[model samples]
Target chain A: MNRRQSKVLRTLARLVIRLWQMRRVLLLVVPYLFLFGWLFAAGSRMDVRPGELYGVTDEPAWGSPDADHWFGTTVNGADLFELSRLAMATSVSVAVVSVSFGIALALLVTMLFVFDPGEKRFELPNVVGQSGFLLPSFVVLLVLTGGSGGSLGVAILGLILVIAFHLCPVLTTWFQEGEDGFDIVAGYALGLSRREIVMNRILPKILRRLVGVFATYVPVVVLVEMALSFLGFTGDRLSCGAMIAYGQGLIIEAPWMAIYPGLMATAVVLVLSLLGWRVSSAMRTGPLPRLF
Target chain B: MARIVLQRLLVSVIRFAAAGLALIVLIELAFCVIGGSDRHVWRAESYGPVPPGLSARPVSWAGLLEDRVRVSLPVLFICVPGILLIGYSWGILGARLRRFHGARLLAAPFSLFACVPGFWFVVLVAIYSYFHWKRPGFADDLIVEQGPDLLTWWHAAVVALPALAAGAASQIRAVSSVLEREVTRPYLRGLFMAGYSEEDIFYRHAFRRALPALFAAGDRTFSALAGSIVCLEYAFRYPGIGSLLVEAVRLGSYGGILVSAFVLAAFVSAGVIFCESASRLIKPEAAGG
Candidate 1:
């Protein structure tokens, strides 16, 4: 082959190595996303939103698990498989948006109020923001949402806002802990510029810590959405928690109804948690006992 | 020193109040915008599906107050001492026994599950309690109901368990780290050179230095417990402040939500100010203040 062709083949080899190196993370994340997409498409066709289909008690109700009805049937004869998928999709989708916005807002709060870049010292965060440290996201959301009835749009917006404020004190404290008390003084004494010192000497130390924050916060936010749903504040009535609430009652009669979805929910949380621990331990300050 | 502390306390209180009052004002503004307009010159004409104005209802709910006093207060009281005793002892021990694998072993859960979903404990406890001991349906209050007076305190312990579990985990980590840093500081070496005893150096100097950190941890734990109570009450369908808020939101009762929000906001504001000032007072700089 010509030099250009050889170079192209070499690039393909490198690409294969890169994918091979990241296979562990991809093995977990891709299937969940693909399944989410498939379930979302299926839900769109079925046109089954949680609250809209909540009171759906029709014929062939409470059918047991079989070939056609994979998981089972709800009281309304709606496929439990579809229900679980839609719920998972709803919870994960909302959590994704909420965590992204929340983290970004938290970073801004830290930069603007908590960390005084001008003085290079920490300042107390807003008092109301401190209130978030005292209160959970759901309490604040309940207070703020008032009577929105947990519509999809309202739930997403409310979750984002709630999570953002709830994270302020947490992020601030983490940043504070990340700062070694003597670092700034030592850096300045060395004749380094503020920007140079921050970029070269400081930000790297804290950036890994931020990765730990992201790992832990995502699952927590997903759980937040689920908790809200558990409290009967389901948007569209489609959440993994709401499904569990409905199925849990029929545990003896139709165990599969709750069991399958419950397992799926557990699996999602478990996988995320393990992934978080693995990633954070690898990047965090302390030594880990072993390789995961 | 007393005068300085008092002055500093007053300033901190004002700052906290400003933050809280700002939120309260924002809530009122939100009410005006989203509450649908019906201002009758000086007063709102009717309360409608939602309440009319901020002054339309009394700020206190008897049930809310009872819940706060009976349920949440006991939990808070229990948690404060439990966290301090457990956090301090574990941390001081962890620092002294830094070479012991068991110290790290004990703290494993905190780092591993620090970010786990908050409600898992509540849910799991409710489920296990239900399956193990057949009580009320739907895990409502798990095993407790509006029974005898003693059971109320029992229920309080049950409710506090989740927060305590998570809080202790975090506290252990925070305490150990702080103590580790303090134990290694040069000042401790100076004390060592001065021929001070180990326990004296630890309790007097190292522990004093770590007190500010302990206060901050307590503040964070208090917040976590408070937040957890809301979720727990809602999950249990208990007649407490959390369920009250959930009910208010469900029914779209502006009076209920607003008044409850105001009271809780005040509590949060006062608690934060006290914790912060208390922390500052312990700091060496408070002398200059």
Candidate 2:
């Protein structure tokens, strides 16, 4: 083949690899982006008074489904449809942001186990991981939110800490396992320090594990958020959880209030889980790449 | 002799701790159920609609748990015992079912059945049963509407035990593998070749060697099951301490929330203590200091 032909073939190969690696993440994230867009659009047309959405008033209770009001009115006179959208956005954002923060926290913790003894101070996070796993995230979110001021930031921050701590243990274990490779020991033998060995040798072994970890965890993170929101811990504005809470009141009246958001949450979680399974399988079965 | 005594004492302490923590959690759940909701309190005028065959009594904590346990217990009994007995019997069954080749297919169903989040599975099963077995006059009629109540810890235990049993069994496989690998090491091989019989090699040598890691692995398995239960409880509306704790926060029930947290903390602290004690038992020489 000519040089041009070889170059095009190489480009196509690279694209295929990148696409395959990205497929799971794209599948999981696209629905979220769509839901979020709808939520933002719904919020822009917010007709309900602010406090009314939080259950301080009964305006949401009075609105009826119509051309103007897509979702019937709540007892508080807010548009149920509008409120649903807002809740979707709030809930998704909380889950996604908290999960992102959690993955970052896990990465940092993994680095400590793999490299940099100086970063070992964060071992407290791993101990927290033990308790964090057994105690439901919603329960922890509740305590953290209930104890702190019920500000959105406060709740999110508290949740982030709970999630971060929970993730660190698993991350630490993965890194620790990868750290046991022959390359790492060889690097140590070649006069490289522990830190150098981890950075240069162990990181490659763990790259795939890290992908598996992140992919597997996204669904779990979303479920935690849904539970929290369902309990009304995620900031009160039409969160997925808040909608369900509202639906609890309206089960006899407008069962859609609960069913819609419940279905949405369930769908999102299931998709992410399936995608995670696919990604992990791909990572495990793929041909071993040449070490540079 | 001192090491044996210490080991016995440690085991006793852990058993006490687990039982005590489980008890405290039960009491907290009772309080939350009875005192939980003051919202929209109105009497149920009559039985509106309940699934046929299932009787709906006045919403009482004791009744709710008893009812749930009654409904869930049969399934749990069938699944748990069936899975364990069948899983262990697979190799035996293979000889008989050689034409059917059922053993290979058996593990996945058992594992999936075992792995299913009990809350979701129970809810799905309950709904399915409700639809399938509908009988006349079974519908619950008028009742007082109140905020959700907590599910008893006994109920949680009953619902959780089957899953836990299945999980514990799976962990046994993993724990034994670790034990088998560690016991076959060179130093241990030398000891075994010289004098130790196979039984002594397993009990005295392997058990002692693998107990620490097995305990740690036990913790991992327990936590994974517990995590699954959180969502499961929430889904089934089983007001176990885990879910009550979630609801308490939602309702701004600070006292209830605090009590639940304390109970959870105790359970966790006890688990850690158990793991530590077991580790010490396995490596008495290391713990001597």
Candidate 3:
């Protein structure tokens, strides 16, 4: 065999060993992958127009679980399985958008604080970070949206605002702490502009920590969405929270209606939380300093 | 030393007040925006409807003060104790559970439990109530009724257990990591050689060092509880500030929303401030650093 071929084989063998080491984490990913795949397929097949019933049929309401309808039907004749899949898709999108916006806002706030520590204008963001941690996201959403009966766009916008504001404080703290640990004085001595230092040197160094923070906050955002949906604050939206709420009445008569959605929500949350924990642990460099 | 501590306490109080004022203004502005009011007044009644024959009256500070206090009291009563209990229990359990070998495995279910949304608990309770309704027995009495009272407080506590457990488990993981690092320090080895029992070394030296971290974890747990309580209150349909806020939002009661938001923000800030002060008192040296 040629020497290049032997080098390629050795690299492949090392990759296999690494995969074996991560088998436990991979095991956790399997169910999430299966669920997401199913959700994608179901979401593609169904025409989901927000605030309009799509899956209603002539099938008996609260029907027992059978081959035709895998998770039975809601009292309104909406397919339980299809509703759950749609809910999952909506939840995933909401979480991604909110967390992304939250991270960007946090980074901006952190940069402002780091660069202009003396300015009184920055104090508002600091107070927000502190106070935001204390108030629940849903309370903020409800207050901002003025309760349910709004359009889907408004509801999603409200979710984004609440989640983003709620998370900004934690992320600001994380980034500020990370910046403190960096050698910014040395960067200045090397003739780097403040913006350049913050954007290129400091942010890249803390990128892993940023990912860790995102992981930690995603589960929180998901839970907040579910809670809001459960409260009927998401404006006629079908979410895991809504599905669970709808299924609660039929637990005994049609247990699958509640159980399937409950299990789906539970599974999604569990997987995300576990993944968050793993990512944070793996990326953590040393003992985490106290945020306060 | 006493003067220094007192000065620190004063600074914290001032900071909290400033933040509280800012939050009130923000909530007021939000109310104004939602109500389409150009008035700069903080009173809810500023944006409230007036009779056609009557002009918009000037803001009444006394009536506003009374209304704010009345709206805030019940929510505080139910939420304060519930949050404190959850934080205290989780902190204590986290500190104590660090020694077990199987703690990682044990924490898995708890972490999952923590991820269960607040409404899921509400749904579970509803389902339980349904089955209980059919049988008509003992469980029916403990379920929360329509209002926020001691009964609702108890129900909130019961529903909060899973989330609390999750918080405690995560805290345990964090505390244990810190403890593990402390154990590896050379001072611990010296103590082991100096005729001190392992338990004595742990309790007297190690646990003391771990207290600061544990207290920090407690702060995080308390913050989390603050968020979860809103959902719990909503699910139970309890007449707490959270539910009141939702109703106000639905009806577009700018005054109610403003009052509720201000009260909730103030309470959360106070809770955090209290936790910080308590943590400092628990470990004076750590606080100094």
Query: Could you estimate the TM-score for every candidate?
Result: 0.73, 0.57, 0.73
Candidate with maximal DockQ: 3
Question: Which candidate would rank higher by lDDT, 2 or 3?
Answer: 3
Question: What would the per-residue lDDT of candidate 3 be over residues B160-203, giving only the tens digit for each residue?
Answer: 55445555566556555556666666777898999888777666
Segments of candidate 2 deviating more than 4 angstroms:
A1-90, A109-138, A149-151, A284-292, B1-215, B221-240, B243-255, B269-289
Clashing pairs in 3: A146-B249
User: What does candidate 2's lDDT look like per residue over B176-205, in tens digits?
Assistant: 445545655676678777997766665566
lDDT score for residue A88 of model 1: 72
Give candidate 3 misplaced runs (Cα > 4 Å).
A1-35, A44-60, A115-128, A131-134, A147-202, A246-259, A286-292, B1-109, B133-201, B210-213, B282-289
- Model-by-model lDDT, in order? 0.60, 0.51, 0.60
Instruction: Report iRMS values in order.
Output: 4.2, 8.6, 3.6
lDDT of 2 at A103: 68
RMSD for all candidates, in order, please.
Answer: 6.2, 11.1, 6.9
Worst window of 10 by summed lDDT in candidate 3 chain A: A45-54
Q: Tell me candidate 2's fraction of native contacts, as a decimal between 0 and 1.
A: 0.11
